[model samples]
Target: MAGRRRTKHRKLVDKIKEDQRVSSVPDEQNSAAADLPTELLERILSPLDLRNNIRAAAVCKSWQAVATSVRKSNRHPWLMICPKVGNSYDFYDPGQRETYSLDLPELKDSRICHAKDGWLLLSKARTRRIFFFSPYTLELIKLPKLQSVHEAIVFTAAPTSDNCIVFTVNHVNPMAVAVSTCRPGDDAWTTIIFENQLPFVSGICTKIVFSKGRFYCLSEPGWLGVYNTNNGIWAVLSVPPPKCTEYLPPDYWWKGKYMAEFNGDIFVVYTCGAVNPFVYKLDETKQVWVEMRSLGGMTFFANFLSSHVRVDLKGKMRDNVYFSKVLYYGKRCVTYSVDRDRYYPRKQLYDWGEEDPFQSVWIEPPEDA
Candidate 1:
């Protein structure tokens, strides 16, 4: 009886141990054993960035269909210009939950600006190489040698009668307006140089802008000029009211800006602790410029110390998202954005970093609000 009881006890313990071992196994393994169907894969791949979506499509047939459809719809994809981190800019397409990281092996110590019509201009300060990126389809165009001076090179593309863009480079003290073409991957950059010396390279950012195939320039002590690209003609522009840049009543916070463009028209917003910013327009028919009415009243810097506006447009801007560097994050530059009343402001966006993002523009993530 005792032997029989001992054997029964051993059997009970062995059964208990087996049950414990089986229960200890992970649930994920069992779920994986069932295998993911096509429905699950579709759910997983959508909502990624543009670059990633492209790669995912190449993996198989089913994924390819999803990526192609999202791209065809023309939804805006988030583009990131990170060089030291790795090669190529990271394009994130939220419409399709996917990311495509294109390889840019030539990018070393390069600074990148906004992407216009899929081509992004990258300037490497050293050897003067312009690596172009077709951010949409991962197409890259490497340009030939050009002047790699200290001045930051800005990029803009437009559709015109000639169907080519004018590439202009300017420093703080505007020197010569060096013009290049709209072709991103071209080696030959022909110059339509400015004949005159740029007045102020040391003072604030004196600049020249192109709008509707017409180029307009801003100089010191309230000087503005317009350039015609088609005929290579140039002329002077009128001035806004001069301000007392010396004294501030301690109640005002305004930093004046020369005429900036919003939707192919010229505008200048003056500040002397005043919020009623004014705008001017280039009357295309009259061949003259006219100062429009005050836009919105008194706007000041939120930090109360630095007042700078670095303006650029975002995706298909019908004057919608206007990008600015209003929020400086303890670096040489800060970025911020605001909406203009009744004005179709293009993308005025900014992306700031903890350290001096060097000259790279920082765009804020959408959910920060």
Candidate 2:
């Protein structure tokens, strides 16, 4: 009996020793991983998606430093769904098809005029006050109240930058426009009344884009107005509008127009009911609009207020045009492939004429968001 008892005690002791040895291996491995070089750590975390990169930063201070350094690399823009009746805003990541909700009371009674460089330019109707808001950091930078309502508003760069300029144009008369300009620290806006040499009418339907120190404003009638910020020269370009408008109905023509700038090139997109959208790029040398069959591996996100472009996106996202409309049931956004010349997730019959430009917007989220 004593011998059997001794044998049982020896076996139990051996089992406990083996269990301890197995557990210690992980700790040893973790210590080695934690001691990895900063460059190696960056390499490990660099390829992760935005969400995963953020989560990895929470592991330790060393990881946080490495992650922050690499977070500003290429990233897709997120769709911001503003609330119609509440303070909760939903942000959708199209890459992951995930939605995140944020309670932002500051956005109440405010209209988003433009989105760029991870900042939103908003205006309050009652106060007629325009401001820049960073959703990620909840930072608000206020600007002077406008004397009159702006038909359209845009900014050259992020509001935090010193070179940032806010520009707006409104119709003072049928042949003249009231141009307003201001910087971040300015107490008041400088207003200039320019009489158009041509019958260029500015209104709420106007689309504006800034490139190469110039602001190109597209009127509802498809006229191009160029404003040079550096030289203070404003003129109506003589170039005729794209010929694609001939195929669109007159009633839907103004609603389907969207303008964007990519790497100093201006692009115009037109959409109609159940029809493939038309794309045109400006030929600066020829001073004419050229129809494009392919976007050359670039993806465009079109919204009523503002539009954005990305190059060399992966998978179906490449050579496609994404609209602000999202299919709620399937949690998928409506994208038109420039290559296939059809809408994704099957053919979609969308009357972009019925879409309210202010319902939702495509916003580039900050790296730290």
Candidate 3:
């Protein structure tokens, strides 16, 4: 009786295995897709914008299967020039490790800023006409033009997560302040205007920059204005280090080299051929301005406006206060990144040997993944 029961159990197991094998079938589409060269396939898809690239992947089972795999790649994010082509774009995704280009409607000729999240700010690089969209969602938002802004250049001074675009406008004069952004569903640039003469009467045309949550600008009148983004008001109230009575022409300031923001604070380096350059910090909470001190941890910021070290658009750090580099220079037109941060000290992010700065270096937005 025991032998007969064992035989019956063995037979049952064999039958189950047979049935399972018969039920499964091969996916021909996926199998065929696996045969194509991935580089060739990516080259085919790489020109599409963030939106239609997904759409092309959804075309057929074979293409979809291949495209799906392409989308999963983890590429490092990079900063690249944005192109407005074919009434659309063929952007390269540094994060994908490979690029797939797709169509972006209504973006032709509109200037584009860096990609953030999945969205791009589309605008006339010179005028205020602007729009925003996510290449993944195919959602487009139009913005209201700043009535006061007749012409402008887009500046991404806000935090990486914010979609708002800022620019200095010629409006009627080419040097006023203007801001615009797409608030979710809005279809156009929502323009904001700021105007007030410099407070103390200095001759510099200071450009506005965003650090933390405040907008800072040193006007031609030699006054620094701190505008709070949340409140939309200028606290142009505090004044420190009075301007010299010896009057210099307004053009003398030459739009001070951008104030670099690091670890949530702003530091503007003063480097000209004429005056001993010093960095000043704004204590927005207390409404006061103070020069960064050498002993108090900010000493590398030493260059005067009267020296050759101060050129058209060049600067350096005098200490570790701005990420710890303590020194940097513009050799190929690009300001070498010198992280004063305690980690890597003055490591080169990009290098071009013996090249004229006119063709080699440029300031750029930090890449966001």
* TM-score of every model versus the real structure: 0.45, 0.80, 0.40
What TM-score does model 1 achieve against the real structure?
A: 0.45
lDDT of 3 by residue, 170-240 (tens): 32232344444334334554556556453333122344555666655554544566656677665455565
Q: What is the C-alpha RMSD of each candidate to the true structure, in Å?
A: 18.4, 12.3, 16.7
Off by over 4 Å in 2: 1-73, 328-330
lDDT of 1 by residue, 252-333 (tens): 3123443445456565443332233334455656654464443332121211111112222223232222222222221112
Local lDDT at 190 for model 2: 94
Across 15-123, the per-residue lDDT of candidate 2 in tens digits comes to 9999999999987876776788999998999888655777888866778889878874356789998888899998988777788888999889999999999899999
lDDT of every model, 2 decimals: 0.43, 0.86, 0.42
Q: For model 2, what is the C-alpha lDDT against the true structure?
A: 0.86
Error of 1 at 23 (Å): 77
Ranking, TM-score, top scorer first:
2, 1, 3
Residue runs of model 1 more than 4 Å from their true location after superposition: 1-107, 148-162, 169-187, 192-194, 197-208, 219-222, 240-263, 268-369
lDDT of 3 at 74: 22
